[model samples]
Target: MKNTTISDLKIIQIDKIKEERGTLSVIEKDVVPFQLKRVYYLYDVPSDAYRGGHAHKELYQFLIPVSGSFDVILNDGYNTKTITLNKPDKGLLIVPGIWRELENFSSGSVCLVLASEVYDEDDYIRDFELFKTLKTT
Candidate 1:
């Protein structure tokens, strides 16, 4: 297998249009670095909350704030970084083996996540200490 670094996480912005009626945004799979296999969105949630406490073994994901603003905290076991998703045109791409936590969601926030693979429990590393060890070794 190849080594995955923390710097691999990419931030990309989509194209959006605003009109009198409403706003429209488009997220293309080809434009992103990873090929998307699944897509999901989180809505009707509270603020200052936490989500996604696990790390994937072979799944890559891109997260975007479609409606409001939020912060995504990413931990590559050895290092950590916080990325703010406030624009519908912008997204953060997360590579595999990185633990991510979503928090500080603004009102009416909609978080859309595009994944490279389907759901698999074995792909997740929930323990932080074990995640660190895996990254080092």
Candidate 2:
């Protein structure tokens, strides 16, 4: 796997079209660094609940808060950072080989995810210790 750190994370501003009624954001292939392969979302999560406690080996993910807000805690084996996503027109880009944990979800919050790969259990490093060890190699 390639070496990745917290520095690789990026906040992407989506292109929006404003109108008299509402605004529309567009996320085409140009907006993302990788080819879009899968899409998913999290909703109706309890305020005290936590999600995404694992890291991916080769998958890249873009997280967008389509409604309400939430906090994403990211780790790169040596450093940690927290980012709050509260807007529909902004997204957090997560590169491969980084640990992520989602928490502090407000009521009725929805997190939309765009992924670079399909679901593969083999690509996941669910154990933090194993992730750290793999990072050194």
Candidate 3:
């Protein structure tokens, strides 16, 4: 596997059009680095709770806080970094093999996720220790 670090994480700025009544955000397939094949989101999370404590072996994801804010903790099997997502126009790109955890969610925070592949249980690495070993292999 190529070296993937927190620095490799991309913050994508999707185009947003604001009008008098409401706002619209656009995500074009070609504009992003990957060809999106799936989409999901998380909302109504308790303020004190955390989410995403795993890594993927072959999937890529882009996350955005559509409503409030939350912190994304990224670990590349060695180093770790935390990034806060608050803007609807900004999306965080999570590459494969990086352990990720979402924490410090504000009340009513909505995390919208766009994925590069469909849901596959075999693609997920839910254990951090196992993920660390996979990175070195």
Candidate 4:
């Protein structure tokens, strides 16, 4: 597996239009800076939750806050970074081999994830220590 670094993570904001009645958000394919193949939304979750404690080997994902706010903790073996996603038009792009944990979900928070590939268990590196060794050596 190729080594992944923290620089691979990218934060991007989508286009949002606000009106008197409501708002509209748009996320286009090529405009997102990455090719989107799969789309999923996370909702109906509890507060101060812990989710996504694994790392992918080949799948690249972009997390966006659609409704409310949330915090995404990313660990790339040596360093850990915390990103807050509160805007409906903003997103964080996470590459493979980086472990991610999502927490501190606000009320009625909807997180949308756009993946580069389909689900594959073989692509995951669940152990943090092993991931560190693999990245360093």
RMSD of each: 1.9, 0.8, 1.4, 1.5
Please give the TM-score that candidate 3 achieves against the real structure: 0.93
lDDT of 3 by residue, 1-137 (tens): 44677778899899999999899999885657888899889988888888999898878899989999999999998899999999999999998888999988898899999899999998888988888887888
* Alpha carbon deviation, residue 81, candidate 4 (Å): 0.7
Collision pairs in model 4: 14-89
lDDT (Cα, 0-100) at 8 in candidate 1 = 82
Q: Rank the candidates by TM-score, best first.
A: 2, 3, 4, 1
Deviation in Å, model 3, residue 16 alpha carbon: 1.2
Collision count of model 2: 0
TM-score of 1: 0.88
For residues 1-137, write the lDDT of model 2, one tens digit per residue.
55999999999999999999999999986798999999999999999999999999899999999999999999998899999999999999999999999999999999999999999999999999999998887
- Among these predicted structures, which one has the highest lDDT? 2
Candidate 4, 11-101: lDDT as tens digits = 8877888999898988875756657778999997789677899888788898989889989999888889999999887889888889899
TM-score of each: 0.88, 0.97, 0.93, 0.91
Model 1 over residues 13-123: C-alpha lDDT tens digits?
Answer: 777788999888776647677777899999877896778888888998988888899888887766788988998888898888788889898999999999998888888
Query: Which residue pairs does candidate 2 place in steric collision?
Result: none
lDDT of 2: 0.96
Q: Which one wins by TM-score: 1 or 4? A: 4
Query: lDDT values of the candidates?
Result: 0.83, 0.96, 0.88, 0.86
